[model samples]
Target: MHLLRPLPQYLVSRYHGWVATSYAENSAWYRRLADDGQRPRAMVISCCDSRVHVTSIFGADSGEFFIHRNIANLVPPYAPDGLQHGTSAAVEYAVTALKVAHLIVVGHTSCGGVAGCHAMCSGQAPELEEKSSFVGRWMDILRPGYERVKDLPADQQVAALEREAVLVSIENLMGFPFVKAAVEGEQLSLHGLVHDIRAGTLEQAEDGGRRWTRV
Candidate 1:
C-alpha cells in the first residue's frame, strides 16, 4: 500500500538484535508456542504508555500473558450495538477462547490519557472535546472515574483519577454478559491495579475498588 512504508532503521536493527540474542536462545520455546498455540494465564489491560512494561514488571516470558493496550487502559460499559469494539473483542477472546484465569486492568501514574480526560472534564482542553478526536472519544470511558476524584485537591486529582481509571475499567468489564457469567461460574477473576512509575511500586484494589493495598 502507498500509505505503508518500510520500518525505521532503528526498529529494524533492534529486531535483528533480538533475533540474534533473545529469540535465538528461545527458539525452541517459540516453536513450541507456535505449534501448541498461546495459553496465557492472564489477560492484562494496560495503558499505552511506553513506560509501562507489564511483562518486565511481572517477570513474565513470551506467551505468558495476553496483553491489550489502549489509551488510559479504559474499557467501556458493555454495548453490543453491532459496531466495531476492539477492546471488547480482545476481552471476549481472552475470556471465552483463551480462558484466562485472571483479567487485570492496570493503570499507571502520570498517564497522558488520564491527563487528557482530566483536562477535557475540567473544560481546559477544547481540542479533545471534538467529536472527530479518537483519543478524546476513547477517553470518554473514564469520565465517570473523573467525576469521583474531581473533588480532590487540584494537585491530587490527576493521581486519584489515574487509579480511578483502573477501577472504572474493572467495573465496565463486568458489564459484559460473558464476563459476569464467567465470574459467577468461578471461571475468572478480576483485578484492578495502579502502578507508581517513579517508585516502582504497585497497589491493588480490594473490596470492590473501595480500598487499595500494596501488592
Candidate 2:
C-alpha cells in the first residue's frame, strides 16, 4: 500500500465529471446493477491495447459484455497445473457461473504484441528471446501462428499473425472442459473477429477461420 500514489489530477477531474454527468444521469440504473449483479450476454477476450475498445465497437452498455484482456489477446492452452492463470479463471467464471451465451476472441490490426511475436520468431528480436522477458514467453503461445504464416511475404506476415492470434485463441478456448461442455450443451458459442483500425472495418472469421468476411 505504501507504494501506491495519489490519483493524477486529470483522471480525478475526469472521474468527478463522470460522476456529475453520466453517473448522476443513470444513478437508478447503476443501483439496479449493483442490486441485481451482472448478467452479461457474452464474454469478450480482447487485447490489452488501449486502442481496442470492446464496448464502443459494439455500442454496448456497461455490464453487457464480460471482458478479459491480455497481451496479444491470446488464450493459452488449457493446463490444469494449479498455477496462477488469470485468463483461465476469467473464462471459467464467465462460462460456468455467469453462463454467457457467446465467447468472442477479438484481435486487431497493427497490434504491437502480434508484431513482437513475429519479430521474436523470425530471429529479429533477440532481446525477446531471453527467458526473463514475460512478453516473450507470452508471445510463445502464438509461435505456432507465426509458423503458419512465416512463408508469406514480409509485409503480409504481421496482419496474418494478428488474425492467427484470434484463431489460435478460439481453438484453445475449446480446450477448457467447461467451455467444451457448454458448447456441446448448446449453451455457448465461439466467435473470432478482427478490427482494421485504419479502415474502421471489423471482419468476422468464417469457414473455421480459413476466410474472413466484413461484419
Candidate 3:
C-alpha cells in the first residue's frame, strides 16, 4: 500500500491541479458545455485499466466522449430484475440522455480479465460457482471467448480471446433497446477497437471482418 501512495496522492493533487488549469484554458468551451449540457458525439465503453485511456487515444476533450468503464469493459445483456447494474445504467444514460452518435467498445491486449478467462479455460483458475467471488462471476462474460480460443498457443490465445470478447460486448450492447433503436435508425454507429498496451498501438475491427487492422 505504501508503494501505491504515489498514485493516489498524484491523482488527487497534481492531477487536480492540471484539471483546474485545463478548465481555465478552455473556459469558454467548458462554460458552453455546462450551459447547453453535454453533447458528446461518442460514448466509449472501456476497461478500468489505467493503461487503457479512451480520451488520450482518441484525442478527445472533456465533453467529446461520454465514457463508461468497468471490469473487462463488458456490457451485459439487459436485465430488469432490479439488480444493481452500473454498466447497463451508464449505457442507458449515454444513449437516451446524451444521445451520442457513436458507441465504441474498446478492448485491450494482455487484459487481466482475459488472462483470468484463459486460466479458467486451462483449468488453472477456480470454477465460477466454487469461487463465490464477484470477480469470478463478472469474468464469466469472457467464458465464451475463452472456450473459442482454448486450443491456440498461449500468446495467440490472449489476442484471439480479447478480440472475440469485443465482439461479444458489441452484441450485448445491441441487446439494449435504446442502443438497438438508435443503431437501426442510423442515429448511432458501433465500433470495436483493441488497444495493444505493450506496443502502444490501436487496431480497429474491420466492418464485417473478424480480424482487426492497425489504426
TM-score to true structure, per model: 0.96, 0.97, 0.88
Residue 87, candidate 2: alpha-carbon lDDT: 95
Model 3 regions more than 4 Å off:
1-12, 127-131, 207-209
What C-alpha lDDT do the candidate models reach, one value each? 0.95, 0.95, 0.84
Tens digit of lDDT per residue, candidate 2, span 1-215? Answer: 59999999999999999999989999999999999999999999999999999899999987899999999999999999999999999999999999999999999999999999999999999999999999999999999899999999989999999999999999899999999999999999999999988898999999999999999
Candidate closer to the true structure by lDDT (higher is better), 2 or 3: 2
**True-vs-predicted CA distance for residue 54, candidate 1, Å:** 0.5
Clashes of 3: 0
Candidate 1, residue 72: CA error in Å? 0.4
Query: Model 3: which ten-residue window has the lowest total lDDT?
Result: 1-10
> lDDT of model 2 at residue 132?
97
Model 3 residue 50 CA deviation (Å) reads: 0.7
Candidate 1 has a TM-score of 0.96
